[model samples]
Target: MFNGIVDVCWIPFAGFISFLIILSAINKSVGVRKAYVNILLRIFEYGRASIESASKENTQSVRENVTSDQNASVQPVKDVDANESTNGATLITRDAVLLPQAQESGNDKPQTLKKEEFNFDFENCLDYVKSGVEAIIEDDVTSRFEAEELKSWNMLTRTNRHYEFISWKITLIWMFGFAVRYSILMPLRVLVCFIGVVWLTVCTAAVGNLKDGNKKRAIVNNVLGQCFGVLSSAISAVITYHNEDNRPSSGICVANHTSPIDVLVLMCDTNYSLIGQRHGGFLGVLQRALARASPHIWFERGEAKDRLIVAERLKQHVSDPNNPPILIFPEGTCINNTSVMQFKKGSFEVGGVIYPVAIKYDPRFGDAFWNSSKYSMMQYLYMMMTSWAIVCDVWYLPPMYRQDGESAIDFANRVKGVIAKQGGLVDLVWDGQLKRMKPKKEWKEIQQVEFANRLKSD
Candidate 1:
């Protein structure tokens, strides 16, 4: 009797439980469907933003801005072919990228010139102007470096010039300083090492601390750049420097990046911080450690992070009165020091008193330039001992503040032009002492060289 009673009541109760489970399942499915729809909406919004940014890349917009420069005189393009223009049958001087016209020969152009001889307005305007940079020394204008001023040695002289790094006088001074800091004096070697460890730790944090998302742990990496310049100075008697108004506060700083010493050289002037990068191995770990202790920032390259965060952080630091100006090598990579490399964009973005620096090495230690490519820390140090001194010029451009609607590329071009004039590297910076680098032609040259080299025999 008890079993029969239990079966009758439990069956109805079990039906109610089953009904509740089905209802809950239906609710979850609806919730998931709504969440997916929300995701799609967000994706659609991002696509809209992408389309808007792409619109800015159109040439029509750039041409419009190009047309409005009122200060320039109108120069007519002589003998331009009508077929190459958008107006079809009419030559559009502005539409064609500016190139120097072939000079007229005695045999050409028999007709006498009339003021309206050509119908087209000649935009003698250049798409990219390559001139040596003008050097500034704190409003105490020293002269500008002319491209003609730089006379190249089919090679720079590196004769039997011997160098003595540690003079007996300096040696004694170092000994005294070392003696004062000896472990015997304070037993602080362990503590100093620990401090280094802590400094490294802080360096790692600093890498990511100020970066906008795309930045690598680059602070330590940048600070380390100073080592190369210093090494160059160690070998050569040329000591080059330029002042930069890095932050908007007091001023900015810019210098020629001849070696790792590029950063060190700037540090000599002010206690500025660096932007660096982080690696994945032991070296990276070591760099990360350095970042943790220092006021450096490390960011991984290609990391999908918002760089605006880092930019804002730096902006705040620069705004503060206590911080020194920010310093950066506009030429992102180290060069052979004969000429300047193409300026990268970030250095131009920070709004402040803008200064352009032109750095060159003296013929002191060209081999140090060699070690710049293949040497590790130990190798670099060894190379430094054997060779590496520099003769360099530091040219500072006038300070600048960010204008409305400026792009990094434009700033790079402008600043590059300034530095080229200042440093006398127009010929050397791009292809070395032959012809100046054309702004648009530079990429084309690389492409052409690659294409031509691809078919070469082994």
Candidate 2:
């Protein structure tokens, strides 16, 4: 009886895998993923409405109790005239302190400073307190490392708002979602991902045996793209590419990094030689497989001469026009897909056509960011598999070249600004590495110097 049940269950799983393979081979979708996303949106909408109604009722009850308590405990203050005096002291109205407007509205004038005794007032410290509070409310660096705040809960408990237990209706919906994600979706996704990786390894190994030529390169590119497509579908990735004409053919392709899947997303459409530190386990398998078929630069993590080796290899790769572009994320770390952070200048120093690609993931569907400090790779993949879907947009901007008299840092910032603007992301000057390390001593010193200068000026 158990054997018969297993056979029956395996039928649909095998059929699903076959369907995914067909989709990957054709490099097209029949709107199945789109339809799935629409269904998820409708479910989220229902949950949001149910949670809002419950919350409104709860808030109304609390407000009523608070209003009665305030009425019982408080007394009204006596009214006082703003301009009236008491005990020989005159009270000034706010209007009395107003200054007259300047007659020359179109012209600018410097204000004359009235020198007075410099007093150390607590009010000056209040500015610091306000800034501190603002930082606490929402900080640039820390918030970029956390999961994005959802306007409505996406039936996931891994968010700030806990609306799963808001109502019996929502609770039942959440339980159903949990069952679907854990019992059905995750296992299928894991199976598909495993098969995709195995397929990639086998195909790339066969392609690697071919003699070095254009034909071999062509075969490698096609195989890698198809394999990446299968892997992306494992997560139900719905990526829309913009400006396919600007897709990177050669030179270096630099993009803002949000997750390791960023490579998988882009590789589904175009093939690029990846460059990064070599790793072990799951990523190691993919890296080794990719390097066998293509000229990817994977260096040892703590090699003494890694930088020079990478620089030399990078120049040699770009010098050959026939070779694929080396994909790079010059930010050096992943960020929550809300902002573009300071990019490292090393990649920009290389003289070649720089292809800037912007990737923006719709967090409403699923958060694509990998907070490396908080979650391990396996844990993150688990979260991704259980999420509703991965929906994102990739914008390939026009190729850029370093202008005359522009430094590498300036060139990098220019590229970062363009990406941030195109993707509607906040352009931040803070380094992404701040997630892993403390701010540099020089950075703190610079702020200290600025504070001292302000004090002197005052």
TM-score of candidate 1 against the unseen true structure: 0.41
Weakest ten-residue segment in model 2 by summed lDDT: 88-97
- Report the lDDT tens digits of candidate 1 across residue range 183-232: 22223223332333344455445564564432342443443333222222
- TM-score of every prediction relative to native: 0.41, 0.85
Q: Tell me how many clashing residue pairs each candidate has.
A: 87, 0
C-alpha lDDT score of every prediction, in listed order = 0.42, 0.80
Best by TM-score: 2
